[model samples]
Target chain A: MRISDKYRYLGIKLTPQRLAILSYLDGNRSHPSAEDIYRSVRKEFPTMSVSTVYNTLDVLKEKGDVQELTIDPRKKRYGPVNTPHNHLMCNKCRHIVDINKEFKFTLPSSMTEGFELTGNHVEFFGFCSNCRKKQ
Target chain B: MRISDKYRYLGIKLTPQRLAILSYLDGNRSHPSAEDIYRSVRKEFPTMSVSTVYNTLDVLKEKGDVQELTIDPRKKRYGPVNTPHNHLMCNKCRHIVDINKEFKFTLPSSMTEGFELTGNHVEFFGFCSNCRKKQ
Candidate 1:
């Protein structure tokens, strides 16, 4: 997918700062947090503030061009994958990998008894290969 | 469920503080954060600190008596429900309700390609009645 086109389609101004952030997130599967993004992009834009990174992520999330992951308690992570998917997190190393599989199970009638289900995200947690190797 | 027995079986010390926290979580559907728990418990034990609440929660989580919810971006919420379940959160008010229904979906092979499946949590987001009314 063309990152540039996605930003334009979302009506976001293609500023150098935003473009830099977008380029970093393009095809990024590591699910980096705001700090990670800031540190990485700051290397290119030395004067970029952490708040700007957060702002860009917020805008991207609002535009549905990215997903904010709350699976980790310490920090908020972001994923550039815009499709319906699930996550597998390594409990030991804190690495997050995407699980591209689809599950056909419907929400139990009892669970959805009252509220209307709008969207769902399924998350799986376990140790990754690297973490397992360390053990 | 008997809070007393639950604690005893879990081998956790039945301190007055722990009991107070457990009572607060019992039958609680409005998922509360650590700060919420500290505030509520502090009404009786004014000396209680936030760290204590977090420590108790960490212990409870390890024993599988409580579940830590990461669906909210601002803070971590806790649930007393021990069974497998899903959550429905209000996007506007941030109210979280329990969905007790069971879904019989198996993960698609492609999604689980190589990683071992351990556990899953499904989260649903939308506006609750109060927020809907306001809108």
Candidate 2:
């Protein structure tokens, strides 16, 4: 079977397990963790170990096919590279949501200290309605 | 001598070591790590330990006098709460700089999933001119 175009650029051997992981990450905005992905993919590959999922993720991360997020502070989450975006998080519950729109910003050269510009990620912190009611 | 007004709101005992730390962090935009603080504070109080710096940082962080940053991935950095600001980083060298200006953004209510907005931090990634030259 041919590898899905989602992971075509990785240029690595596409094991059945790696293909499953890549399929899971395609268009995934929930930013699930390694364990989260393993738990879901394990349904199909019952014998698959979490390490397999981690190794696949590590390879994808190194290959720039995936982006890692630690917006939750205590846990790692993964999102698809299909769109460059930022994140919004609930300070109380630590729930994270994606913000697909890019903000236009430029730092004065004096402030950047001669760094050539590339890209930016904005993390917005807030209280979810449920958490806000708890206060 | 009286403690500087910078730490007056923390309301903790003004030990000489804690004072030195607060003084070190006061108006400090370098986003130094615990070891960085320890290294600099050691110059004056050779008896001071790294843990002392860590504990003091914990208290200040708990009290909201400092904000922790993990931009470097391998290490943690810190900045004072004196002013709300964002950061610009060198993707090549991982050098970080402060951008004191705030970027205004509004997420559609539908996008937030009912989060009450509070604050945002933008992390700009780039290659410092020196690193670009080296490449």
Candidate 3:
């Protein structure tokens, strides 16, 4: 979908700052942090603040248009893909890539006996190709 | 298991400090942070540092005797139970409780398409009883 349409679909007020963010995130595969997004967006809007970047990201996340990843411990990463998917994280260089494969595993009845299951996320951690080359 | 026996079984050398930590985590379910552990242990050992608490927790985690949780954003929480389980986090009060239930859900093949799935975790977010009462 077009960036303009995404903003309209999310019912978000289309400000210049927000449009820049949406444009940057559209089809962006590299999971970027709020700081990373702020620095990149500031290239055009030199006066953009980190807080604004975070606020915009939070708004986008709440709208279910973007996903926040906790794969990294230092800072939260944001992904443009809103679909259910898994992540591949390189432990050496902290690089994150999307795995487009489907997983099939039934949780044994012994694992979820009482509480209601809301959601599930699968994460694969290992050395990526670049990091493997370094070693 | 007894604290002394746990250390011996894990092949970990037991020091007075280490024993204190083990005793504290033997069956702990509160999901305490490093700071919380350090503070609690400090009542007995006045000089216990935060770094020691973190180091001990890291070693314990590596040995598979404790599990570290990313449910909290500010700090990592550790659980004493090594069994597979899910967590219930109260968004309002930040309280974490364990749900000793088994979950049964086959991940649709569309969810894990290209990558090897090594592990999975289920996290449920909601207001706990106390937090619900507050609202």
Best by DockQ: 2
Instruction: List runs of model 1 lying over 4 Å from the truth.
Output: A1-11, A83-85, A88-100, A104-119, A125-135, B1-11, B83-85, B88-100, B104-119, B125-135
What's the lDDT for residue A103 in model 2?
A: 79
List lDDT for all candidates, in order.
0.69, 0.71, 0.62
Against the hidden reference, what TM-scores do the models get? 0.71, 0.64, 0.64
Q: Kindly indicate the candidate among 1 and 2 with the higher lDDT.
A: 2
Per-residue C-alpha lDDT of model 2 across residues B59-99, encoded as one tens digit per residue: 65544455666465556677675445587766445576778
Better of 1 and 2 by DockQ: 2
How high is the TM-score of chain A in model 3? 0.64
Instruction: Give per-residue CA lDDT, model 3, range B29-97, as digits (tens).
Output: 677788888998999999988888888876655444556656675677766644444655544444656
For model 1, give the interface RMSD: 5.0
lDDT by residue for model 1 (B1-135), tens: 565676776566878887788789987877789989999999999999999999888766544456676778888888774444577776445577776654434556665545444456777654465544432
Best model number under lDDT: 2
Tens digit per residue, CA lDDT, model 1, A17-134: 8878878987887778999999999999999999999988876655445667666878888876444556776544556677666544555656553444445677775445554443
Give the native contact fraction of candidate 1. 0.44
Model 3 CA RMSD to the hidden true structure, in angstroms:
7.1
Stretches of candidate 3 above 4 Å error?
A1-12, A85-119, A124-135, B1-12, B85-100, B103-119, B124-135
